[model samples]
Structures are given as C-alpha cells and as structure tokens.
Target: MNSKKLKILLSLFTLNSLSLYLYFSSHPDHRRLPSRSYSVSEYSPPHHPLSVKPWPILPSYLPWSQNSEPPFRSCEAYFGNGFTRRVDPLKPNAESHRKISPSAGGGGWFRCFYSETLRSSICEGGRIRMVPERIEMSRGGEKLESVIGREEDDELPNFRDGAFEIEVGDRSRVGKKLVDEEFLDKYLEEGTIDRHTMRGLIGSIRSVDATEFVCSEWIEEPTLLVTRFEYANLFHTVTDWYSTYVASRVTGLPIRPHVVFVDGHCQTPLEETWTALFSSLTYAKNFSSPVCFRHAILVPLGYETPLFKGLSETIDCYGASAQELWQKPDNKKTARLSEFGEMIRAAFGFPVDRHHIPKPASGHNILFVRREDYLAHPRHGGKVQTRLSNEPEVFDSIKSWASNHPNCKLNVVNGLFAHMPMKEQIRAIQDAAVIVGAHGAGLTHIVSATPKTVILEIISIEYRRPHFELIARWKGLEYHAIHLRGSYADPPVVIDKLSAILRNLGC
Candidate 1:
C-alpha cells in the first residue's frame, strides 16, 4: 500500500488515541514513554510546555510587489510558509505555488489567493500585497462581499455567528484606481489555469489599523468570547492570546471567526493553522446571516489569554471525556483518505461542489478493470502479478455485457492509472458514464465521480470489504458487489451475473 495513504490511517488512529494521551499526561495515568520516530519528525514534549506569548514579528510589515507601479505592503499579516521539501527554492525565479485573485478598485476590498503548494506560503505576503481598490460604492448593499480566493465562498469556518457591516468612506484610503479597462481582461474569472498574475486582494485590508470599525477597525469595547483551558496538543493556542475579527452585528462582539472543527479546542495558533483553515474557509458552504470571521483558539488549563477577542471558527474540542473520545471501535474507521480528501476538497474551493451533477456525464461508459480489486493481495501495495483482462473471462464478460446493450458503452482504463495524478484521472473518470472497478485504490477515485454513476465493486470472498460500499453510500452513487471465491480458479470469471447486477441497478 502507498505509505502516504497508510500515513493517513495512522493519523486517524493517532487522533483517536489522543484522548488517551491526555489522560496519560494527567495524574491518574502518569507514565513516561521513550520517544519514537514520527511520520513528519521525531518529537518529544518539552520538559515543560513552551510559552506562547506575543506572536513573533512578521518578517516585514510590507515589501515591494513585483512589477508594481506603486509602493504597497503585504496583507498576509504573516502566516503560510513552505514546509521542508526537495524542490530548488529559487528555481523558476518567479514560480509561485499559490493561485491568487485580486479585487479591483480597492477600498477595503478583499483580495483572494489560493495556495497550490502545501507549506509553500513561507514566502507569501512577501510577494503579494492585499491593497484595496479606490471604490465609490459601485452598487449599494447592506453588506460588503469579498472573495479571498478564486473559488467558492462560504460562511467563515465556525462562522456560526455575526452580521455584515458596511463601510462608506473616502475610497482614497485604498490604493490607486488604475482604471485601465485593459487590466481587467488579464485575470481569469473561471477554471484555474496556469496563467499567473501577481495580484494580492483578499479580506479587506485595513488601510490604517484601529482607525475604522466596519471590518476595518476594532470596536471600542472588547467582544465577549467563550474559551477553554484544555484542548488538543496540536491546537495549543497562546496564553494571553490577543486577536480580533470584524465586529458582530447580532450580539455585537468585535468579530467572531465562525467555528468549524470545534472538536480540537486545545489551541493550535491561528497563524500556524492558517493555510489549512483558509483552505477550508474557501470550501465552506452558504452562510446563514451575518457571515463573519471564524477562528479557533487553544489554551492550557488555568491559563488565560489577554482579553484578546478575535472572531474565528473557534473549535473548542478541549476537555473532551476520554471514554467518549478514546474508545473507538475497530472497522468503524472511515476511509484513510477521507481527512486529506477533506483538505483537498477545501483546497479545491467550490469548483467541485458547483460542478455537482445530478447524473454522471452521459457521454461515455467506462469500466476500469483491476486484478486486485476483488482482494488486496497480502503483498505490500498489493502488486498485481497478471493482466486481469487477459484472464479468460474478465474482459470477455465485459465484452458480452457491452454487446448485450447498445446504449451502454464500455471502455477500459488500466489499473496502473489508479495511483496517477488524481486531477487527470478524475477528469477522465468524469467523462465515463459507468465505472467498474475492483476493491482497491482505484475505487478511491469514486469520491470524484459524477452523481448517478454506476459503480460495480468486485470483491474477494475471503476478504469481503465494506469500505467501497461505504464510499458509494456516502457518494450517493449506485453500488453493488460481485463476490468471487479467491481459491476458485475459474479463470477469474465475470459471467452474466454481472449483467444482471448492472441492468437492475439505477445509475
């Protein structure tokens, strides 16, 4: 099996066990264990928890943007960075791993950018600036709508709170109007292409800090916030933490990050989780009313952050009871890829959701045949030793099934393509009307299928799997199983039974 996929499984298992570790850290289960190698890196808890006080100063307040006609500062306020990698840092001199979208005629305008490379934001903001447009309220609305990136918009993560605010002031506070009509044609308004533009417009940038109040300045009073002392170790937020979001219109807190993932309340600093969080923010669905900032905070027991009240989708998964959290039943585990898939989905912005089809594309019917789908060979990665199609009956059966129906088309995409780039594979599968595959990694692609796609999962009797069935159910696709006797060497047959199953099922 691919180590990366296995790593995801290990991550889930580790999360399930974290509640136990919380217990182990306390008096009832006090015990010390030697350190071991971790997937990312070896880590050992500090002899004492490290202090997180004043956030570190960002590299620079502002920098010169490339090809700029005027001076501007970066709006990132210092988050996002590159993780350790092998790629040459300076290669393709201007190569940026993120896709950014900019707002026009800026005055408190939101500029959007989506990071394409994980952890590649280390040099962020350095290269881009979130300057506002010189706006004169082109159209009137009760609230301002700003898109931070190129795709789908949603309620800020845990943004289960707040109201929109309107700002009407001298548009001059934003940068130059650069009203050249030709500039607008440069950036794309649709599908993300490789085309690159150095524009930095995201959440409305504060022209002058503490000077305005409408998503621009802090209210005179501190926003009332709910917080906790305990939280997940990974989410540990700073003590005396101070932050702010746009003021709430309902209860009227300065700003609240609408909450999501409220499950890990042990504060992971907002800056530390910004990339992952922002990706989710772009993926969040329609908000109710009062869409606003959503943030998460974490803290240690008996410690408190400053009256720092920042709006966030503050997930407070702290102090969860161990019994309710750590006691997980085996086999109940969701797909190992599900979490990463969530991140990717969020990263994908709304393109996937907006493309949701009530039915699979009707253009072509494709069945991907694989040798190990029926069973995961005990070997590592379940390497298939033979051609599944050449086996007397697998292809013949598929051929016969195709011959029986004129409307139903059948095409073959190899199993080798299963682990290929998902973007390309998914694009191909998107065009396939019917997808037939075995219970293997390729089946994971079902997550990208068009609705109404028929999926036939071939299973091994000795190792019947409910995993594919599980995904099919969640994906809302038509799915059924073909059980085969692993020990029976009937030339790996696919008989008329396959036809009966497909013809009877709705796709």
Candidate 2:
C-alpha cells in the first residue's frame, strides 16, 4: 500500500513541475518571485533596473554636474590625464612652468586647487592688478613696471592705418626677439599677441601670501578666474565664453563655477549674457576691498593656450582643433564644435539636440541676420558702416523667394538681433534651418546654430574674411558664400545661391 501511494505522488509531482516550467517560459514577465519576507541568510538584493540600460546615456555625457553629482576626486582625475599642471611654488617662473605639456584631446592648460585666495590690489586709475599673485613692493615702493622691468601690454593694438603704423614701429624690437615673420603677419592682420606678449601682460607670479591683503568679502563657492578684452564684440566674447566652458570641463567641477572677470573693464551690454552661464558673475572693480575665493581655477587665456589658439584672429577661434576639449572620447560621430554649440544652447535654456530631428510639414526656417545702426558702447555714436549697400532690398528679395518656393514651404525670419533680447536671439539662431547675413559680428551667432543648419555668408570685396567659413567647417555644417564685387550684392544672385543650397538640402 505504501509503495503504490509513493509512486502516484512521484508521478503527480513530475507532471506539476513540467506544467509550471512551461507556464513560466511563455509568460516571462511573471517569472519574477512575488514579494515575501525571507530569512536574513536567504535574502539577496534584486538587480538594479538601470543596470541593463543601453549605451549613450545623455546625462552622463553632460560636462556640467547634475543631481547626485559625482564625488570630487583629485585634480588629475577630474581634469583628465595631463590637463592639470602643478606650478612649482619655489620656482614659479621656470621654463617648464611657461607652457602646459600637451596631451590627447587638447583641453587648454588649467590650474586647479581645492582652495586658493587671491588679493585684488587697486592700482592707478582704479585698475586692479592682473597678476596671478601679489607682488612684494621694494622698500622704496617701486611701481609694478619698475619691478617687472617691462610695461604691461594690456591694451589691444588698434588696426587703423595710423595706429597700425605706430604699433609696428613700437613693437619692432619685441617682434624681432620673440616672434617670426608669420607670427608678426598674424599679429598685424588679426591683432593677436604672442605667448611672450601675453606673459608680459600677466607679469611674473610673485609670492602668494594670503596674509598680505585683507579679505573684505569671501566667495565660498568654487570660482573661476577669467581675463577678458575691454570691448564687447560678439566674436571676442565667444572666445571668452568658450574658454570659460573649457575651464569648467577640464577642472571637473561638479557644479558650474562662479565666474570672476579679472579684467578692469567697466560693465558692457554683453555682461548680461555672461551672467546667465554661471552661478554668479562679478568684475574685479566690483570688489571695493580684496575678495578671496575658497576654491579657484585660474583659466589661461585662450589666445596663448594651445587647447584653443588664435583668439584675436578674425577667423574662427582654434576651437575646431581642440577636439579633446569638447568631444567625448567615446563619441566620435558628433563634431567637437557641435558639442560646444549644444553647451551654449543648454546654458541659454534653449532646446538642444534638435538639429537633426525631422522638420514639420510647413517647412524650414531661413533666418536672415540683419545689421543695423546701434550704440555698441558709450564712446561711439549709433552709426554702423554699411556692409551691404542695399541690405533692405536683399532681405525683401529673399523674403519674396521664400514665400514663392514651390518645392517646400519656407519661413523667412528677419533676425534683427540688436532689438531682441540675448535669449531670444539665441532661440532664433538655434531654430533656423539656414542663416544668411552680410559680413558682420551678428553672424557669429552661427556658433550656436543646430548641426543641420546651413550658413550663407555674403562677403563684400572690401570686407573679405574667413571667419564664418572656418566656423561652419569646424561645426560640420553646410556653408556657402556670395562674393560681392563691391559693398552691394545683387538680389537675384543671392536668391540663386539660396535656391541652389535648398535644392541640395532637398528642400
């Protein structure tokens, strides 16, 4: 009787086991065990849902920190290999300290410290000393110039006919000693000073004694030290902003650092734009007494740093060459320039990564950047030289063409950047499918354009330059040009070029 009962139970158990296996295999979602209490010895944590997530995580790729930011490690780890160069405190002026050793991915040289305190001592005419550290005055109270033995080259050379001639003669000896013909040619054409000149401007690094200067106010957050030009031209400002971004990336700050403009220049119209990119923005002049930063990064000038070069040049800033600074090593498909463009768009709170997305049925946006008379600064009257003799006529013709185009619907945008707020201007540029403009600073907005955007720059014979052309190439955007015989571009010729570009883009 016991043998027969055991046999029946064994057969039932085998059949039940087979049926459960089949059910679980077919309904895999139900395979997970139901919630239940377990003994301490038997308990095992479930795997994280995100553990099997796919590649190319968006938030991880962002240069700036987000919620649950990564922990702050050593400067070497944060800045990547070979990006941070330690300055020998004893021999700060040694030859090795003059240049940062090169590394892959080409991020510009930067010095980061867990804590750094700088004293801003006011000089004559309310200009704060621009040196990295405070200088010890001789017992006789000698001026900085007498102590350093060379006058600072803080002022950019004016390239006007008379000023240019005077500058060449004035710097003739320096040019002969520190630079070659090609360097001098670039200096003359682009107003770019060499490394030696930049070094001279910054002066020698003196003793860093926090006790020497009193701190009236202290900035507790991480801060970045940036030197900028006095004027607010869009091109120069872009270089400064880009350099700041590179500094943020290389330093590996978990959060965006507060930016301190170390220059003595008064506030300009563009200062508002600078304020938006960081946690805070302050000028050297703003500190009535010496202010100290808890954690500081002294960012080198983009002009002198190899990570990006040719800052003063009318052509694109050496951004295209500094792929290491912008492009993540793992992602080779997106251009480094485009990464920077995305950074700027994100900083300005504009929609990002929308360049390659399919367009709506209505059609593409053709943005025509218009240059008009406006007061850029206090010194000059509100009068801009006419680059396009008949700009209004050309704009009208383009508008007409966009409306009549049969291939696809076209939306022509009159990009009157001067009248628009900075955010609105960026929005217009980022949203455009094509940007058209005469040779002007307003055209610099193309740096923030979407990847798929096309650029059509009209160069008058009088103002021929490669600024926008080089930018388009670096950004991997399609670019075209219309060469005008004079300051005037024929409307029909521009329309033809626009039509051809749209045709190629399958408009």
Candidate 3:
C-alpha cells in the first residue's frame, strides 16, 4: 500500500512541474519581458541641455556666422594656451567630441560655440589679439567680442617648449643651398632635377604646420605667420604664398607669419612689395622681438610631388608629410583669390577702396604686355631660340585694331616695367580692363586686377603651360588664349582672332 501511494504522488508532481514550464515559454506576455528589458537601455536618449543662450551672430569678416536653424546658442569657452578636446555641452560624452588644439602652436584667446539643434560646434581656429584692459578678438581687420563666464580645462602642452620649432642652424643655409645653388644648378646644369632632392627641399625647412609656430614669443596675443621660403621667382613666390592662405582656411585663424629666409634675395621687389602691402616682412632670428602668435597655421605645400602626398586638386585630397598635419593646394579658389587681392590692395598703403580704379573715360585700357626684351632664364637673353617670336607684329596688330574703336585705349608695355617699382607695376595693371600678354611671369600681376577684367594670354605652342589660364579663371576674369607658330622670338599670332577678341570685349 505504501509503494503504490508514493509512486502515484511523485508522477503527479513531475507532470505539473513540466506543464508550468511549457506554459511560461510560449506565453506572449512572458516572452516580451526579456525584449522590453533590453529596449529600456537601447532606446533611452542621452541627456542634453534643452535650451541654450542665443548664438551671437558673427560679422561677415569674422569667417563664420549663424546660418542655421534657430535655438542656436554659442558661448566663449576659455582654454589654456594649448587646449585640445571638445568643450562641455557640445558633446555630452567627452570622448565623442573632437580633439581641438585651441592654442594651435602658442597661446591666445579662443572661443567655442554650438548649435543645439544642429548638434555641432564651431571655434576660433586661429590666434586672437586682445586689447589692453579689454577682451577683444582681431580678425580680417575687424574687432569682435570675447565673452567670458564659460571656461574649460586647459589640456594643452607647454607651447613655449622647442618641440614645435624646427631649427637647422642659426642661419640654416638650407634656403640658400636650395634656392641659389642646388635647386637651380641641379635643374639647369643636369637638365632634370631629381624628385627626392626637390621633396627634401620642400620638407627640410619651409614646410611646417601653423601650430608649430605658436610659442611664448607672442605671449597671450594672436599671431599671423608669414613664411619666407621661395620668394625670388614670381611664379614660385606667389604659388608658395598660396600656402599661407591655405593654412588660414584649414585652421580658421588669421595668418600672422614670421618669414624665415635662407637667401638675402629671398623675395623679389614684387614679393616684398606684395607682402608689405598687407603684413610686414620679418626675420625669425629677431628673438628680441620674436614674432608671437596666439593662433598660427602652417600651409603644407600641395604639389604633384611625393614630399606632399595630396593632389593639386582641391577635392580628393588629404594627409600630410608630417603626422597630425593637413595639406591643401596653393592653386586658385575664386573666393580665396578675390580675398587675397583685396588684402593685397589694402596692404600696399592704399585705401581699401575698390573705386580707386578710374571709370573708363573712353574704353578699357588694352595693355599689351610685350616680352621683347624680357628674359626669364639666365641663358634666355642671347637666344634667337626663345618661345615667343614676332612680338612687334603682335603689338602692332592690337594697336591697329584699337584705333577703330573710339573707346579703346591701347598701351604697349614692354619689359621696361620689370625695372619699375612694384607699386608702379600694381598701378599700371590695376587700371587695366584687358590684359593682353605673352605667357610669362609678368602676368602674375593679374592678382591686382579688378573683377570682370579680361585676360588674353598669347601662349607659344612650343612652351604651353596652363599656369596663367588657372590664374585668370580663379580671379573671375574673362580669359582668351591665342596660340602662336614658328620661332620663340617671332611667333605669328592670328590678327583676325585678336580683332574678334577685342570686338567681343567692346573694344
């Protein structure tokens, strides 16, 4: 009786336990419990400030403005001379924010602002200058407010340390050796310059990041970095100068640069005059008065060479010769080129007035740039084998065509202007409506020409280069090209084509 009773009770208990387990596994409410618990963690939004102070609208000259949707708020957050990493509220998670170097190379005033709706932030990428007893920001010739009350931890390194500056020797004959001897001799004597040698020259001294120049020299003010690398040849000097502009674009900082020179003749009359017009030329060895920069940027050389890995095109470019560095081309982008021109006109001790160009009394000046007596290469002088020939006929035909139009003003400017002061050169080209010239470095003066000007480039078929063509396109000028055939000294230009070009320009 005891065995039968125990077996029946055990079997009944086991059956009930199995039935309960099966019911819970298939039940809809019981199945959803696990997923609901997981969703609580995944779908919960991170906490962020619902409201922010209205973002102050920056002036146009200040580089940026509040162009997004409303609820835009920005505040000035202070950082130590060398601060990196995102500020508070910009990104709730400190790790997710971008690593920013406020004192790019040295220490100065820095600002960070954000748009809550856009979930993005913008900061001063360059050095900011402060007035005595006042917190002010100086940029693009305008003064801005440096509001306080929001300060972040200064996570920057000791900017005064020599870690940023790269020195070879006191005089560092690298510049001289490259420009005067090795660069020229190797290219001229050897007929073909080595690529590694050229790349070494670019990376050796001249190519440094803008942040590398930030130091205690400037103390606590903003600095503009001016580089004096290759300023002899007009093409090399101007193209090199494009790096400074590119640095500013990359860092959002003003370019207050210190010019380092290897050659006594580092800059030509035009180069010197061009720089003097906006920023002063200075030597890096002037330690007693070392150029101080709060916000500094280095324009990496963008070339078709290996020393700089980026391509010449603006799009599809990145990486640098050095780590943590960015690279961009010195070629023309319309807005940047126009800004460069305006800054140049302002620097030359002239009023920044665009109206200085006199209205056309009759018609625009058809300034014909003749290369009759001009020579680029040292061996170019005694050559009957030059690329441009029949210069006299080209000038004569343009003059003859101009006579037919009452508004057409014809001026034949020979190479004599090369000897003129840079100011005179700027003045001569500044008022020109139509710049007609042979393909040469003299055409670089088009940087001073007003917008909507016409540029007619007479290129020799033997030596065809798109340098000036790119310049004209960037400067927003009307460009027309005429090819020549025959000898360099007397290549023939199509007179009828020249006449048609003049007619289209309302000559």
RMSD (Å) per prediction: 23.4, 20.1, 24.9
The global C-alpha lDDT for each of the candidates, from Candidate 1 onward, is 0.29, 0.51, 0.39
Better of 2 and 3 by lDDT: 2
Instruction: List runs of model 2 lying over 4 Å from the truth.
Output: 1-86, 90-205, 208-213, 305-334
Give per-residue CA lDDT, model 2, range 1-507, as digits (tens): 599657645654554455446533422112333245333233222212211111111111333322222222322122222232222112112222232221101111112222111101100000011222231211211222333322223322111111100001122221222223443232212233343222322233222221222233435444676665534577767766766665555444445667766543444556667767777776544555445443455554544322223223322222222234335432212244565667667777766647348876768899999998876643445688788999999999999988999888999999988778888888889888889999988888888887678899999998887777777765667889998899989999999999888987796
Selected candidate, larger TM-score, 1 vs 2: 2
In terms of TM-score, which candidate is strongest? Answer: 2
The ten-residue window of minimal lDDT in model 3 covers 74-83
Over 1-507, each residue of candidate 1 has an lDDT whose tens digit, in order, gives: 899757645654554354335423321101222133222122212122212221111111111111221111111111111111222111111211121211111112121122222111111111111111221111111121221221111211122111122221244432323212233232211123121111111112233211222222111111122222222111122211211111111111112222222111222223233332221221112222112221111111112111111112121111111122225411222221222233333332323332335433442455564543221211123345432333345655565556556554445445445244434454555555567665554565565455556677666655464655655553446776666656232323444555555565441
> How high a TM-score does candidate 3 get?
0.50
What ranking emerges by lDDT with the best candidate at the front? 2, 3, 1
Measure candidate 1: CA RMSD: 23.4
TM-score of each predicted structure versus truth = 0.31, 0.61, 0.50
Q: Write the per-residue lDDT of candidate 3 for residues 1-507, one digit (tens) a residue.
A: 599657645654554454345534322122212122112223222122122111111110112111232221111011000112223211111221222332222122222332231122223322222111111111111111221221111111112212122211223222221123443232212222223222232222221233333233333222233333234356565655544443333233222333332111222355556456323444333333223333333332323111111113322212111111113321112134445555555555444335335656656666766543433222233233344566677677666656665656655444346567777666667667677777877777786676656788877777677777766655557788877664443323445655566677665
Q: Assess the local accuracy of residue 175 in candidate 1 as a C-alpha lDDT between 0 and 100.
A: 36
